[model samples]
Target chain A: MRKQLPPEMLARDSRFVRTSIMDQILDPRNRKISERTIGPAKLAPGRPASADRARNLMHGIFTGEIQALEGAGRTAFDFDETEAPFALKLDMARQCWDEARHVEISIKLGEWMGTEIGEFTEATFLYEAACAPDPVLRLCGVNRALEGLAIDVFNTMKEFGDVSGDPVLEFCEDWMLADEVTHVKMGSDWLRRLTADDPERRERALDFQRTVDKLFSLGGFRGETEENPIHLARKMREMAGFSTTEIDEIAELSELARAEGQAAVEAAGSA
Target chain B: MSDPFKPRPAFAPWDRRELPGLFDVEESARRVGAYKWIETRLFEALGGWIATVPELDVKMILGRHCYHHAWHAELFDKRLPELREMNTDRLCAPANDAMEEFVEALREPDAPELTIEKLVGVFRVLIPRKIAAYTFHLNGTSRVTDAPTERSLEFILQDEWNDWREGEMLLQSLIDTPEELERAIRRQHELEAIVVRAGGITGLGTIGATTEVEGAGV
Candidate 1:
């Protein structure tokens, strides 16, 4: 009989546990001196009122997203046991923790911005749509669709922060962007594992993509252009194993969204 | 630019005992089972697709992925004993029948090329999500002082990121056809939905929950 390898052995060999981006970001030297200070001092009192309000609103939205993830993280941890490839399970657990930490970071940022997390009245709808009863659908919606959107958002925020010379926001965006990629990868990995055997699963996946595209477009999560957001989405989907045809469909959907937006404006002008 | 050349710090120790306030062992078990079932089924499907591909490089990469899946299965299977020891009921739920059927369909001798393309699509969509998951964990555990589990996750996140990058490179290099690429993306979207749904059913929502703020009192 073949001797079964211990979970410890498998855990030991796991690449997910050793080289986290968090470790890179939290270097003692990288630790900001300002993090130690709290409250109004963190924000310049003389900053323009409008600028402060905008920052506060952004911070509020960020905090709300974090609160939303608290429940989401718990859900992910609970599913850790069902995740196969012991490495993947470990990865999933890591993801749960990562999301939880994101919430913390966001909350801290919110404090700095002089705002608290707002209640998300539409939270249940987002969760219900993303968290279906089927594992495949769940992965597709949350991991591929929602998390994929996150990558785009973070990347944009990172670029915006860097260009605008905001160290604090840049730091947060950089950290979040790196983690967002990994989250999407986990979803891709499992999706590949789950549907590897079914020829028809591809069609099923396409259907899900269409639904996600529609949902995101309608929800205003995705932009109506084929620029950075669409490109990033395409890159993410490709990494997760999207076929060219499906990508074209996504592109078309994006174009449709743009067209619809234009038409709506035209109709409004006529009215 | 603020300190672009900051020196990298020594790796931090990861603490496993710092369980989140809402840790649910039973839910974790269910998730593990679900992950295993999905992974095994995907492996079976991809293995079939690899068989049909005439290209040597494609076959080689697919084979490596297959080995990874096998390793993943072995690791998950080991968890069964641990779950049993913990007296976690509902640990023995049967594998997903729909996933099994999907695998069986792929196993058919003359499966169409579109089917293989779909398999590729699934991978394209799911990998980035995994990358995001790893990075999230890495960021979350950064504040912990001395935990083995945290250290372990750091490594895992890095490797997973590497895997995500490599998978993207492979998709670009190995797949020559546009149709193949499109199918790959569509499949990816589909799998994402499935994973999210699974998490909800198994109460894996904790995966996204916030950690209670650790005051200096701890």
Candidate 2:
């Protein structure tokens, strides 16, 4: 037996029917085209040699993404404790759900690429990177760092998806990018609060930034040369709250990665 | 073991009036002090990452957490005067030390940004576990009170449980990359050791050990 509430009472209560940002973003009414006509009818040059490989990679990425979303959810829950400011808790809750949707969208994209979500392998770098014990660090690494990169990745994918006339990928990228911006903003706000008084903490955050640079500098399999290396890396950092100095460091790191990646490719060609 | 006097539901949503003796000025003051220390540490850690990490999302999230913690501190302040007579020396002392250590860690000049592995290890592995323990303690004692304090604790406990779940998921997701994942796993072990060392010094456990120890001394 459940208690029944009047319509007026139910309507008056805000929490009972709270709609998340994800719900708004994923609504079918927002769809511009049907799924049938969304993706490419034919594969492009330099596309992964096999759709199977592409699907596998996408599945791995999606699994990592989902895990990060779960972590963000936990942080939000903890913040809810001690009576965290109502508005902040609400915002965190919103971000948690958005991340969940981002994972779902990515999974769908993986399916479109022709692969099922894969099992967690020992080689999952993104998964490991997000396995921190501190709330601040978890937020910094997953939401700010990984998802920050994701914003750039999605934007680039959106451009490619649009040019390739792949409406499904484009739609996914667009919605994800919008949600990521808010997620990044949430991380920035929280990071600022945590480090306001301490210079050492600021330095450590900068160090993490450098790590991001090193990790992403390897460039993606899709085509490193095609990407706007400097702009892509710099913009992501800037959004994550890097200062002018830190941004310069990131740029330097990106250039180094390009050089190294090129050298490896040339060596392989020669061999 | 079921008493007729017990509430029908094992886990009913909390009602403030049910817990009458929980919100003593002294206890509230102690909890506020502990929360303040935790808030400061969280802020410092997040700030450290933002300054170093080039990833926009990481910076944004850290900044958000920092702001929220500051707000928590402000709210705690509002409750301080009410317990002005309570001896908060013990609660305040270890917090001071932790704050000092955090500041020292932050001011050490620039280096390579911590690897995602390291950052996540610290944030997701260590911090959430400690918070969970703290919340559990509160939950265990909260029901003993027949006052509003129990209600507040209930709310916090629910939140902490959610936090733990999310943190575990984050940790599990790091399986994508070997190197980064390994580093995070190592760091988690290291955090456990550090927390254990700190735990013994303060009887109230790791999350608020300093404050608890300080309160005991007072």
Candidate 3:
């Protein structure tokens, strides 16, 4: 038996063609369509049935968890026992357990919402964050950024469950949401712990987090505005120990990304 | 020669109240500790298979299994304080060297035949043992003192059975040669012998033999 390195994964899947973040950002079809034109209520319903949307989101949740499990799993394995302490690896291992449960829960939730696995296309943006070579950066990218996105998505779905008066969705989302908060905090704690003596290394990791946070904003998929589908979970982020200024900066980055997306779309139209 | 369905003497009494006593604190800690290791190892094994396995369907199954183990670990960890076992730190450590050795094997860089080896070890040996252990403990423990643990075990045992069946299907489908199957079975037994010798789940030996509860009803 010989040791094999972790295999490289392409973001595209054969069953599902990925709609790149850039493509999703500058979607020409959505160009020239204003929030006012569609009206807030009408924007909620698209050609895809609510069932389809739910299914798509559930699939995304399902895939996200798998990547999360992989990320945590890799953290547990890829590092030497000395590079990252045994306890940190154990923490990652423990998180793998949480994430594994989340994956199953999401699968059940998908079934509950009438969605099947692979019913919708998956984008691998989440997994990309986990691929960072440096564990500190990976922690910042995955635990903080990716899991932070999970908090927002889960909270939004939880609200959707509450508004729709579906106890199951509300209950499941709430349970998973609590776990996401812990995940983000774990990342935060690790980032500090791993780089406590070396402030420069800590700054580099924090910078990586900012970059991911901006990318995740993805031209306003998330923001404070009503036009955004998933709102920034300020209170929840605070509970996870994110400062108010940090939350505000994320909101600003989202707005900036949205503007940049609009410019790119307009430029393409002119071309 | 005894029929499992045959009614037992009423005097033997299906005592639900004395179930908790069947597993003392040390016994409870040992089981929980092993569960934590199992969950952790399963997580790593799934990752190995997912990374190396060419078949997408197999990867998907491993993905789901990965999370199920995670949930089982959490459930076991959570059960600690309830059993009046405050030092959950004990739960994190391996109960014996066999568990430690098994995890070390899992953590080593993937072998070319790693995916098959993992499937064989988990489905053929580890999961079956887990099912047996849970079923044994389920029967021995009192429902009155620990309904939650019983329910948890029931849920986990059901998953373990499903996973084992699914794994068997994959193994049968993927391994073409009888030689491969023979090697897989042998590989699992070798590892199984270590864990059993190093004080298997409850120091009771493998459940497949010692606590072979007929019609246990997962």
Q: Which predicted model would earn the best lDDT? A: 3
lDDT, residue A239, model 2 = 60
lDDT of 2 at A128: 43
TM-score of 2: 0.43
Worst 10 residues of 1 chain A by lDDT: A6-15
**In candidate 3, residue B198 scores what lDDT?**
47
Candidates in order, TM-scores: namely 0.42, 0.43, 0.66
Writing each residue's lDDT as its tens digit, candidate 1 over A135-253 gives: 56666666666676666566655554666677887799778767777777777777778778875874576477567665555312355343222233456456545567756766566
lDDT of 3 by residue, B72-170 (tens): 777877887887778665666655555666556544435435556767777877777778788877877667666778888999998899999999998
| Model 2 ranges with Cα > 4 A deviation | A1-57, A74-93, A119-122, A219-224, A227-248, A260-271, B1-218
lDDT of 3 at A17: 45
Q: Please write out the lDDT profile of model 2 over residues B142-186, one tens digit for every residue.
A: 344423434444554454455446445544653566876776666
Stretches off by above 4 angstroms in model 3 are A1-19, A22-27, A30-36, A41-51, B1-114, B122-218
- Per residue, candidate 2 scores C-alpha lDDT tens digits across A1-271 of 0111111211111111223333433444433322234333122324445344334445545655544543443344334334334344445545545655666677679768665544323133454454454455655676676666676566666665687677887888788777777777777786677677876875676467557556665532222344432135345546656567755665566667656655555554445
Q: What is the iRMS for every candidate structure?
A: 16.0, 16.3, 4.9
Q: What is the DockQ of candidate 3?
A: 0.14
